[model samples]
Target: MTLEAWAVAAVLYVFRTLVDDDIPLNAGCLEPLRIIVPEGSMLRPRYPAAVVAGNVETSQAITDALYGALGVMAASQGTMNNFTFGNARHQYYETIAGGSGAGVLRFGERGEALEGHDGADVVQTHMTNSRLTDPEVLEWRFPVLVESFEIRAGSGGAGRWRGGNGGRRRIRFLEPMTASIVSNRRRIAPHGLAGGAAGACGRNYVERANGERVELKPCDTVEMQPGDVFVIETPGGGGYGAP
Candidate 1:
């Protein structure tokens, strides 16, 4: 049901956006649109189906496809950067921010207008719309410390209009806990549009207490011992114009 709604919304949103037209909620704009999905398809899952995993990846992929078909922009970081960590008592989950694809123009993560072919930087895009939690609040509640959280500068693709930049987050566990990372764009880079360049792929790893570094898979849970730090470097959006 979630995907169904999202697809419908995407079509309406993209239809108006391509021509820089305003969207009206009245029947004049929506009356001609029709959405039909076959039973039990990926978009319309049967009851009792799990959607968390599908929701994150499929929605973003769908939106990217929508825009790609219109040739208006490039692809954004396709994952929600889902992060979750917990022990027997404490728990935390968040969808970290990343770059949005560069179009003829785009806004900053804060909604400010940016020049040329640059997309928004370190902002929430696509299906990963969520608030960025305050670091102090996290530290106050959890047994972990936020070592660093900032933009992975220059991580965006280079183009006539550059792709937006992704972000870097490092959290050190003060106690033993379990941490899981579930995301995409780790292997395949976000695609560019026109004569633009492809964005950088995302990366995740752990710096163990013993100074050893270990890479993590797309979907994996790891034991975080004391002094171990988990780092997430999200993917940037793809550039839309020639470099």
Candidate 2:
């Protein structure tokens, strides 16, 4: 079998093992679903192609693509918002969750409005379900302080059904350290559907002790100094329908 097929099989196997066993734990469960991976594409990268982002970023893109193809709403913040920082002795890594896209509103048989579901807030979904680190644990283990963690208001797209909001996280360093960020949706916003507005784009930056602000790209690695502040504003999800 092709590499893509193998990967899908492995994913399905793990999923089956984790979920209920009501359905037979065999290949029959996958018989009904059709999966296609284009040759040399990101999903099926050719030899020597760097696939570091495939596990986190590309997988989210694939999920968004599938949802978009079904004319569902718009794309979510399609990144894992991976962040890592460390010194010579201590290292830390985290995956921050972003917003989820809103879907089209449903109607009843009598043409009456039904209960429309809103997108999820700052929470992980799909393939990446890792939990956030506790603030107390972080403070005890690393030379950093959690400045703030809160929902970013007015970040989701506007529509009949609004999308979920992203989150903002700020951290202050107690000592010099090195940091790296692997994320996406920095340049382009998550798209909306059916006349809905696009969601806000993500941002990564640093504030020096001298009050200097430096913007960072989607994938960046930088050296930081003591008293420097790192901030991450995750992207919001797109809206579904016209207002």
Candidate 3:
């Protein structure tokens, strides 16, 4: 099916599962929602398109577009930061989490104006709710070593209500393997709203056994040898108001 069709189906399923009212799970629930997919667009790619990344990356873009159209909030980190590695023997895939966008400002109980609500930190939004693999489990299951995993400090935008921070993960290969990454928000930072500041852009890099360092594109596939380290720095959310 098309990316747009898949997204609509996933969303409708979630809505149907969440409603507690006597409404039945049927096509009628989707009547109030209008889904439009433009031809040749990212959400609706033409035939022969490589849509592997659309399931994770483009879904977040669709969420951002919907939020923008509704004037609900600023844009979040529009990526899922998918990473994969394997040899002929085994393969593993993972989706690293990023930050969500901030909501509009509101008044405090004391009658004082407050900044917008802060976005979620290092989480899967929209239709994705998958959790990160445990470091111990990942290390035991693959020919890799977890060097470090932590939040990227000060990566969030500066504003009255600051955005949530992204995550940083580094892994070292124990043996030669093939690696692939599918992600976004590398060139353009997450957008801000109401004069807020934009969030930091994400980065990906590889450290070779020979002490050479190379930056990877947002979407890329590469071959790796032993002692190679792969690092991913996810994007932070956009701030909601002026600082």
Which predicted model would earn the best lDDT? Answer: 1
Using all chains and alpha carbons, the TM-scores for the candidates as numbered come to 0.84, 0.86, 0.85
Question: Could you give the C-alpha RMSD of every candidate to the true structure, in order shown?
Answer: 5.2, 3.9, 3.8
lDDT of 1 by residue, 73-186 (tens): 788988898999999999899998888898855556874435545788889886678996799999999999999989989878888788999999999999999999998899
For model 1, give the 10-residue run with minimal summed lDDT: 18-27
* Ten contiguous residues minimizing lDDT sum, candidate 2: 10-19
Residue 176 displacement (Å), model 2: 1.0
Per TM-score, the best of the predicted structures is 2
Write model 2 residue lDDT over 1-243, tens digit each, in one string. 444654575456444533445787677777766667788986687899876766677667666666666555577888999999998898999999888888755556874435455567776756578998899999998999999999988888887778788899999999989999999999989887667777899999999999999999999988889899999999888887776
Please report the TM-score between candidate 3 and the true structure.
0.85
Please list the residue runs of candidate 1 whose C-alpha ends up more than 4 Å from where it truly belongs after superposition.
16-30, 34-51, 105-116
Residue 79 of model 2 has an lDDT of 91
lDDT of 1 at 148: 98
Off by over 4 Å in 2: 1-26, 104-115
What lDDT score is found at residue 101 in candidate 1? 91
Ten residues in sequence with the least summed lDDT for candidate 3: 10-19
Candidate 2 to truth, TM: 0.86
Task: Report, for every candidate in turn, its global Cα lDDT versus the true structure.
Answer: 0.84, 0.80, 0.79
Residue 204 error for model 3, in Å? 1.0
